[model samples]
Target: MHARPEAWILSIGNELLVGRIVNTNASWLARRLTFMGFNVSRIITIPDSIDDIVLEVRRGLGKVRVIITTGGLGPTHDDVTLEGIAKALNKNLILNSEAYEMIKEFYNRRNMPLTRERIKMAYMPEGARALRNPIGSAPGCIIEVDSTIIVSLPGVPREMEAIFEEEVKSILEIIAPKISIVECSLKTRGIPESSIAPFLEHIAKSHSNVYVKSHPLGFELDKPILELRLLVSATSEDTAKGIARSIMEDIIREVLKLGGSTSSEYCV
Candidate 1:
């Protein structure tokens, strides 16, 4: 979409739905996907129910270029992400040889047997390739259906990050659009967000390629501090940064005209 590949992050876990744990996986994946030139359009959280997973996974398939799912991939009965994905794609869950070996080796080193629960991590949807997890028992997986790629990672933060870095990054790089994004955050004080709402909207409308948003850091009734983030995507890093810098300068000038003070402008 918009000349950039689109992606979605689907986080599945009962704990997440119940607020027992934070959904940091979605935010981490979102940042990675955006930095890789994919427009992360949605970050969805669903319960670890097979029906819910099937619904969301099927919704993402063929609609976005990439879909990344995290969580519910452990050895417990509640860990049924793969099963739900298989059902979503109308495929059978089969023991993946590569994944099985990875799991077996992980247990062998620990002098542990391949119990039924442990072996459960080896099953995946048909035709999916197992990604080696450098930090945990469960190996991740990637599968392509039509033009869409679906990647599933373990819920553990360290395990998910490791697999994505070691295995999934290469695959995504192959399909990611040749685009660069530059993001800059500027801090503004002595002006409330409401006072700058119109200006922000005008800036966004003026630059169709640039994304503008404001994060308020203080109460609106008082002299509020606002963190303004400007993001622009271009074919090269220099071009993207230049556009973002120009936009930031314009915003800063406008804020100064409105009796606001600006500081701490940095790009990433």
Candidate 2:
């Protein structure tokens, strides 16, 4: 009944900016958030600068309901995401007892001594709650500012995904309880995107809850090929699934009418 919550993703690290490492975190988060019935508006990639991080966080908080940042949560000196968050929210950087305990246990299990750098990971923005990272030493954090939730996760793909699945997913489920999203994809062999553009536009306009997109795969012989993706969000699973099925049927019918052939089965 209400509009979907808007989300913004921020990726921080000089490695991402300089191409030293690929920024797969943004794409992963975007896809997951979209499938969870969120309107992912923008993805921003910035260097590991405290000022830039603080500025972006402040700006994103003004617009989006949820902001997720990946990277810069390590024990190294360049790991300044917590500092930026604290500065932006006017909160003090203090030792979080929960985070300290988690870090201590993790290091102790590995028989690693607690060094100064390792201790830095326990300092988080005041009033922030730590999200346990089962796979890594750096614990993620969540803080609310002006009713907007900001989540900080590690840069490593494995650790980030673990924290998101184990901790953040439950929080989001509670925040947006009424949304149910369903998606279906159709792969066609002989249809060009240009030919199906008008039909997709019409379907999108007529069905406001349904999102139709065409992705052009490479040509097969002389024929242009593409995949059609359909997504729907509703208050219930049955409604969402039904809408997606109906849309897929309509698309298949149109493709057949246009003399185009499909090589793949409908996937939901």
Candidate 3:
């Protein structure tokens, strides 16, 4: 396995487009992938249209090494993800035998009708790898387009989470082969991006390999909080941990001196 350049997450669903859904899938998966040491380039939300889906997939292929798409893999008319992905890659949509049988068994177990529409969940693009979904009927697929690995998962958060854990996570672990890519995150209270920009600029310039990102989640007890991400690249877990720890200590001291109190030295 070789190194992963990065991942571009494209979350689909008309609900997400019209603001019916908040797109928690992309945010959740992005943070998970980043913490696992695979870089996430961008998170985009698009409507359930073939032209738009293919366009975004084609565009993301050029910029990122991987693409993970969520939504539209259900048994409804709007469940057009399979069709769009096939159209994008000029691939054929065929029913996966295993997935078909799995869905059949599910309906049989429930004593429900084996309708053709319900079986639609088993269809996938030709030459694509199916990602098993133990929790739902919609089986996901991982395909390669222009040398980019594109993962299509169900829209349901629990189902998406299961397929990714079963399919994508292990693949990334194999590709990266980290003896230990240790990371440390610091959660600080009452600090805005403006106040930390200059300090982060210096830190970033000094440590090019160490990545830092701030996520503002309104803090506990009515105080605003920012989570500082400190990622280090090293061959060993201990070495990576040491590098992250050192960088974290420096940032904590600097932020404290700047009148921003830290809620944690290491956030998990």
Candidate 4:
């Protein structure tokens, strides 16, 4: 069996750690990576500290095929993501002419003077490819270290998304797993997650490729509500969908047997 390429999303920013902002970038990247046929192994949010970024980057190297980091790519002092990544790989932070030109163009169009702080966005790890940001000034970067590819993107959601869609998506396609993923989600009532734990386990053991998980939504003592999600991957779309449908039917049958009601079934 062909193993799916594993990935990690490293979100950097003090605001995320302090709960000042939600980590939407991580979720967006996770969904995108999953759809691209990569298994997202971890989503980590850390402060805008160079030491912390270094630790995480070092940890992700050699462990996962891809590591995508969002945030700390701004012109501010706290934007040390690239610096940390450079230190982790023992590579020098050099002035990338392409990135500098992109940033210069952004400022030149608005008649804004290029300050040292603004030019800071042009420096990236040596041998990194600069990805243009269509909606923002900061240019993202892609660095290949042996078998691991690290992508550093701006913290801004729109800019990150633009760079991913226009630039990074094609690069990832070359390495993305050639598999089809089918997912099913169902809402159940009248039974708690504990009641269906055994059934889910049995299904998981029977079908190793399917991922089964339950999210409890309501109070167990009063009205039990759960969101059951199943994901399966196969070599083709028809096979994946067949497996997912079969698993969904089995789960529904088990839920009805346990005196539970299911609704809101959807596939994605």
Candidate 5:
């Protein structure tokens, strides 16, 4: 049996693309998903443009099992993620009364008038399931279409993190099979990248399920250290972690066997 490749993150907002905002949402989502043992296969950023969003959605749907999008989901003219998702799936945005009432209450609580524009935040792609925004005005949505699960969350990091943690987490746990990609690393001193290439390659071929890479720091500054990472992708966290742990143990054993000093981190 084999594990399915799962979960891609899509970030939406013109601010992100134009560099007005650094995309903390993607990293936050990835870290959370990784902790939950979901394979964070890919992460991409796009503008608020519908065409761009739809294109990325279609492309991601083909490759990843679950698609989680953040940003462009608010009660404003520029918030077009809902329509983009609907178009990508060939659906329409329809008014969701539950969401409508929620949005209404949001305004009422703040002592603000519910303008027709703000109330429109209740509209969702037809057949989309609403994921309540416990902290924000816009309700996120989860739609199951063509075997792919799409979850949309607010772009604001706090709100996005909240909804993902509170709402989408349990739902995905129910629908998604257990899977994980785990990795552990070793920091080697007195070793250069060129010197470790063959060893890295040897380890990689021996474990087809694992990947190895070396990163060098401070090469131009006359002092450089090499980092070797052993990445393992498996169907479950235990399997992935087990493999990673085994490899790390083997590397430690080898270094100790050779009377060479190794460290968990490179020191200055």
Candidate 6:
């Protein structure tokens, strides 16, 4: 069987590295991509240096099918993500007319003056398609290099999310069709991760298609509460859900046998 297409997330910005901002973009992208049936292999954070950005993008390219980068696509001098990407792909940074118009319209509507600094947001790597940013001034860009898709989005969480939901999501669905991802969790009290490791291992080994994980929910009194997450991916929703349900049932039975009492059970 062919392996699922893999994805990598690159969060660019000096602020991320300096701990000025939390890197929530990687987490959001990972969850979204996983739901879309892509395996997120790695997430890398780098400073706002053109050399560093180029190096990271080059490394991710050819390794993963999709690379989503967030941050550094701004009007300030530090915003050099487009330059780095163009350098990495041996392309030129050109004024994207569509992106320029988008930014222009945004500022024009707000009665803001269009300055040279603001126009810098319109530049993108050559042959890149501009993705409309509904909530912000900077437009995202998408480029394909050697069969790998490179997507660059704004650093602002709100703008990134808007562009992703409105544009990137559909592009991803079209490029790498969606699979049914069914997941269910069972909460067990008075059980620790150590105690449930063997059962989870057994279930995972037996049902290769199902993913089993144990999350410890801290301590209640002296014992650790545990949540077992079961996930399965299939061509159809019913098939995926049925497999997840069956695997969850088996794990629950094992938990009960191990003297752990179950409390809540639900699909997610």
* Best model number under lDDT: 4
Q: Rate the local accuracy (lDDT) of all candidates.
A: 0.91, 0.90, 0.81, 0.93, 0.79, 0.89
Which stretches of model 5 miss by more than 4 angstroms? 35-37, 179-181, 219-221, 233-242, 253-261, 265-268
What TM-score goes with each of the models? Answer: 0.97, 0.95, 0.86, 0.96, 0.86, 0.96
Candidate 6 — what's its lDDT?
A: 0.89
Which window of 10 residues has the lowest lDDT sum in candidate 5? 259-268
lDDT of 6 at 105: 98
Alpha carbon lDDT of residue 202, candidate 5? Answer: 77
What residue runs in model 3 are displaced by over 4 Å at the alpha carbon?
Answer: 1-4, 177-181, 187-196, 213-227
| Model 5 agreement with the true structure over 100-142: per-residue lDDT tens digits | 8888888899999988788777888899988878898998888
lDDT of 5 at 95: 92
Which of the two candidates, 2 or 4, achieves a greater lDDT against the reference?
A: 4
Q: Write the per-residue lDDT of candidate 3 for residues 1-268, one digit (tens) a residue.
A: 1153688888998898788878889999987876676778789889988899889887876567778899999999888998898888889989978778778887888899878789898888887877888898888888776777888999999999999888788877665445345567788886776788788878878875676778787767876788887767666667777778888888888888878888665634
> Can you rank all candidates by lDDT, best first?
4, 1, 2, 6, 3, 5
> Model 6 Cα displacement at 54 (Å)?
0.9
Q: How many clashing residue pairs appear in each of the predictions shown?
A: 0, 0, 0, 0, 1, 0
Error of 6 at 184 (Å): 1.5
lDDT, candidate 1, residue 268? 97
Task: Please write out the lDDT profile of model 6 over residues 1-268, one tens digit for every residue.
Answer: 1157999999999898889988898899998998788888899999899999889989987778999999999999999999999999999999999999999999999999999989999999999999999999999999999889999999999999999999999899986745778779889987779988987888888775678788888888887898888878888889888888888788788878888889789986
Cα lDDT tens digits for candidate 4, 176-211: 988988889999999988999999999988887788
**How high is the lDDT of residue 7 in model 2?**
92
Q: What ranges in model 4 sit over 4 Å off?
A: 219-221
